[model samples]
Target: MPNTTDIELRGVSFAYEGVPVLEDVNLSIRSRELICVVGPNGGGKTTLLKLILGLLRPDRGEVRLFGGPPRRGRLRVGYMPQYGRYDPQFPVTVTDVVLLGRLGRGGLAGRFAFYRAADRKAARDALALLGMDAAARRPFAALSAGQRQRVLIARALCCQPDLLLLDEPTANVDTVIEARLFEILRELNRRMTIVVVTHDLGFVSQWVQTAVCVNRTVVVHPTSALDGNAIRDLYGDEVRMVRHHDFLSKGGHDDE
Candidate 1:
C-alpha cells in the first residue's frame, strides 16, 4: 500500500474574499512520501494546506483525502500551523497543549469529554518522539520559540496520523535544531506521509522527495528540478540557491 494515494486535488481553485489564491491546482500525494511545499510569501502555501486539511472549501474543483472528502479523512491527518500565529501566552502546560490534538477524535459530541488514559499515554509518547518529554509539565508560554515548535509538532504527532502536515516547522529553530527535527521527521516518514510547508528548499531537500511550488498557481516538481533556473522560475533571480551543506555550515537562519 506504499503507493496508495493519500491526498488528491483536482482542478482545485480557491479564493479569499473574491481574491484568487490557488488556481486550477492538481496535486497527488502517495503514502509515505515526504514532500516540502515551497513558495514566496502570500503565495497560497498555507491556504493550500488548509484546503487539503478540509478547513477551507475550494472555490472550484475537488479535494480528496484517502479517496474520500477531506472531512472524513482528516481524522487520520495531523496538522501543525505556523508558529507566529500563537500568542505564547497560554497558561497550559506542554502536556495539556499536546492533548488538544486528541480533541474531536471521538466525534463532535465527545470533544469536551475527559481525556482517556490512552490519550494521555499517546500525548506522552508524542512528546517523547520530539525529545520534549522532560518538559511535559513545563508552562507552555515559558518555553523558547524552538521548544514551543517542538511541542506543537508533538501535538500533531499525538494523533498518530497517516498523513502529517506542518507549516514552518523550522521557523524559530537554529540549524542544529532544524537538523535534529528533520532527522526525527525522516524517521517518521517511514510510517506516515509528510507534507511540510516551508519557504526554503535547501533546508528540507535532503529529506523531501518532492517539492510542491505554490503561488497564484500550483506546480509539482521533483527535488532534482531545483536548480538555479527552477528556483528563479518560482522565486526571483535575486534569491540564491543554498545547498544543504553550505547552509548548515554557515549556521544560517532558515526561518519561514
Candidate 2:
C-alpha cells in the first residue's frame, strides 16, 4: 500500500509584484515523513512554506493539504517560523505560551471562555513531550535559546497536529542542543509528519527521509541519494559539503 500524502503542490507558481519567486514547482509530502527543505537565502524557501501553509495564493497552479484546499485543513497543521522575538521582560510563562496553540480550535470564544482544565492538561502534556514540563512555570524570556525553541515546538504540539512545519529550527542553538533538537524531532516524526526548512545538511543523513531543494524551481531527492555533487548543483560553486561524521561523532555528540 502506498503512503498517504499530506501535502501536494502541482505546477505551482508565485510572484511578488510581477517578479517571480517560485515557478512551476511540484512537490508532495507523505504522512509521517520527515522532510528537510534547503536552499540559498531568498531563494523562495519561505515562499514555498507560505504556499504550503495556505498563507499565499499561487499565481498559477494548485496546493492541496490532506486532499483538500490547504486552508480547509489548517487546524491539522502546526507551524514554527524562523524568528520569533519576545521581550525579555514579557510576563508570559511557558505554559501560557503553549496554551496559545489552543486558540486555533477555540478562536476568540475560547479565550473568552478562558482555558478549561483539559486545555491546561494538554498544554502541560505537550511541554512534557519536549522535556520542558519543569519549566512550565518559568518565564519564557529566562530560557536559553535552545529551551525557547523547544518550548515553541511544544506550543505547536499542543495543537495535536498531524503535520508540523518548522523553519530554521537550529539557527541559534549550540551544536549539542542542535543535535538534541533533531533527536526530539526524530521521535516526533514517528507520530506526525514533519517538514523542516533548514540550511544544515548534517541531519539529512540520520533523520530526514527526503530533501527538497528550492531555488526558482523545486526538486525533491531521497536523502540517501544526496551527495556533494548534487548539493553543489543545487547550491552552486560556493557551497561545500562536509561529511556527517566530520562534525558528529559515532555516539552523535558534536566533535567540537
Candidate 3:
C-alpha cells in the first residue's frame, strides 16, 4: 500500500508584490518520510515552508495537510524557525521554554494555567528525548548554540506533533553537533514525518531519503538519485558537491 500523504501541494504558485517566487509547483510528502529542502538563498525555500504551514495563501493552486486544509491540521505540526532571538538575561529555564509548546493545547487560557503537572512531564520527556534533561534547569542563555537548537527542538516535540518542520537547523552548530542533531532527527523520523530546509547537501545525502529542490519551481528527487549534475541543476554550476566522507575527514564526528 502507498504511504499516507502528510502534505500535498498542487500547481502551487506564489508571488510577492508582483515578483514571482514559486510557480507551478506540485509536491507530495508521505508519512514517516525524511525530506531535505534545498535551494539558493531567496529562491522560495521559506515561502514554500510558509505555504505548508498555512501562514501564506498561494496566489494560485492548493495546499493540503493530511488531506485537509492546512489550517485544519496545524496542531499536528511542529515548526522550528531558522532564527529566533532571545534576551540573554531573560529569566527563563530550559524546562520553561519547552513548556511553551504545551500552550498550543489550550491556547491563551492553558498558558495562563501555569503549566499543569502533565505539561511539566511532557516537557521533561521531550528534553530527555534530546538528551537535554540535565540542562532543564539551566538558564536558556547559558547553553551553547547547539544546545539551544536542541532545546528548541525539544520545545517542538513537547507538542507531540506528528510532523516536524525545521529551517536551517544546523546553520550555527559545529559539525559534531550537527551530526548528532541529525541522529536525533533520524530516530524521530521512525515515528514522525520530518521536513528540513538546509544548505548542507552533504548532511542531506547522509541522513535524508528525499530531496526537494525549490527555485522558481520545485522538483523532488530520491537522495540515491541525486547526483552532482542534479545539484548543479538546482544550485547552478558554481555550486560544488562535497562528499559526506570528506566532511567527516575534516575532524567532523558522526554520532556513535
lDDT of each: 0.84, 0.81, 0.83
lDDT of 2: 0.81
Evaluated at residue 178, the lDDT of candidate 2 is 73
User: How does residue 19 of candidate 2 score in lDDT?
Assistant: 85
Candidate 1's displacement at residue 165, Å, is: 0.1
| Candidate RMSDs in order | 5.9, 7.0, 6.8
> Of models 1 and 3, which has the larger TM-score?
1
lDDT per residue (tens digit) for residues 46-142 in model 3? 8999999899999999999989999999889988876457777899999988998888676565857677888999999999987899999999989
* Clash pairs detected, candidate 1: none
lDDT of 1 by residue, 1-256 (tens): 7999999999999999998878999999999999998876666889999999899999999999999999999889899987677767767999999998888777544466688888999999999988899999999889998898899999999988999999989888898888898899999999999999886676676677888877667778876776667755645521433343234345443433
lDDT by residue (141-195, candidate 2, tens digit) is: 8998778888888888888899999888877777777787788888888889999
Displacement of residue 85 (Cα, Å) in model 1 is 2.3
Candidate 3: worst 10 consecutive residues by lDDT?
237-246
Stretches > 4 Å off in candidate 3: 86-91, 106-112, 227-256
Q: What is the lDDT of residue 142 in candidate 1?
A: 90
Candidate topping TM-score? 1
With candidate 2 superimposed using the best TM-score fit, by how many Å does residue 83's alpha carbon deviate from the native?
2.7
